[model samples]
Target: MQVGGKSQTTWQPLGWTGASGGGRVGERRWRLVDVAASAGISTQQVRNYLADGLLPPAGRTPSGYRMFTERHVRALAVARRMAEGHGWARTREVLAAVHRGELPAALAALDAGHAELDRERAEIARVLGAFETVLDSPAAAVPRRDARIGVVAAQVGVRTSQLRLWEQRGLLRPHRQRGTGYRVYDVAEWRAAQVVALLRRGGYPFDIITAVLDELRSTGRPDRVRAELARREQDLHARSLRRLRGSAALSDYLAETVPAGTH
Candidate 1:
């Protein structure tokens, strides 16, 4: 049937306007154990999902035993997939809002996850741009020869104490002379210091600088920057796909659920 230019689904109530998670009227009920078996999880785990708001409320027998159906089963499966993409904490928030009949809150939680990924992608692009700029600057290359802390600090125009602080923060690591106990940096570490100096001048935070230098350190060649960025882009794409899949599953699961307060 078509309503308001949208195709109606079998599992949806004649009107599915409320919120998610309850069996449609007249569906045959299943035991809680049956619902657990259908999803290959232990009954105790299913109970935990219920307590955790990962599944919708179950029906009840006249004698007060818990009753369930495919609605609950689909909720379990859809929730697991949502967790796979959105993380367990986020999935719990979404599901809890859903069971409370708060569809808007549930959708907002999903939107926030997508927005976070969008921000990460933006950061990756920004890092790539900054990295290219730094590669063309005086920070371009490092010699394999060793340099003491003072020399590297002078080359980067940063105070030696600042370099020591960066080391304390785990932003970079330099070697020590075997007996003299002096900090010494070679090509890889010097390049890291230079990158940190350039990014700090550009106002990048320590966390982002760490990520940039970590990636750059993998090969230490300017030409390899794009390769790393490409790999990171691919990872983001995979995560986006997983979230999309989770949303699609959620749509189907919601359609099958009875309208809130109708049961």
Candidate 2:
């Protein structure tokens, strides 16, 4: 059906005798109600899916109605299946996989697995890069020389609140002025905070971070500290890989059983 500023095509189940199916591959657009009916869901549910980022942005008519494309319909169907059948919380993962490379025969299932792996690999690479930067930089001689919370947080891609929390936990001790109460940290402290931020981003919990910080503070050996951090990062990477694999497998299984046309 062609409406105000868009077009739509309906999907009919394939015929047993191989006749022309009701659905057309090149269908250009769909109304909100049409999409909801085709996906066996309510219009409100469709809106909910869009709000949750499950569906991509749809074309809008001059009359203010949403118009969906074939791709959008297929994607929404896959996302609905994954969420309802496989318990997947994120739809972006499936969509990303589809966009990353050529999709396989079971597009939705393949996308789910690929997306999870891709995410983990990217995260691992980022953490490893941070680890390398910290280990390679020369340790500053003075411990509390030039730490700016905002600057350091921006440099390390962490939140300022995180830096403050680390300071409160004694993991970082930037110099404080007695009269004005301004916090200042030296080069060494700044480097230490950078290292802490790297590990925290790699998913290290507070307790482990505290323990590692304590060891570094007590010993003050750059080489030993670097080795310890590397070891911990490797260990965490392995654990993350295992979890990623498990999540992919679960998603694949769920995708298989999900109803194909569910919104």
Model number with the top lDDT: 1
Error of 2 at 233 (Å): 18
lDDT of 2 by residue, 161-257 (tens): 8878888888888887668777776776776787787677667656656666665676587576567656766765665565455446434533542
For residues 1-263, what per-residue lDDT tens digits would candidate 1 score against the true structure? 68799985333333322233235666677888898898898999999999898877775667777777666777899999998788889999988777766677788998999899999999898888778767777545566699999999998889999999999999879989999999999877887888889889888888778778877778677678788798989999999999888888877766655455432
Candidate 2 TM-score, true structure as reference: 0.31
lDDT score, residue 158, model 2? 78
Model 2: residue 141 alpha-carbon error in angstroms:
14
C-alpha lDDT values of all predictions: 0.80, 0.58
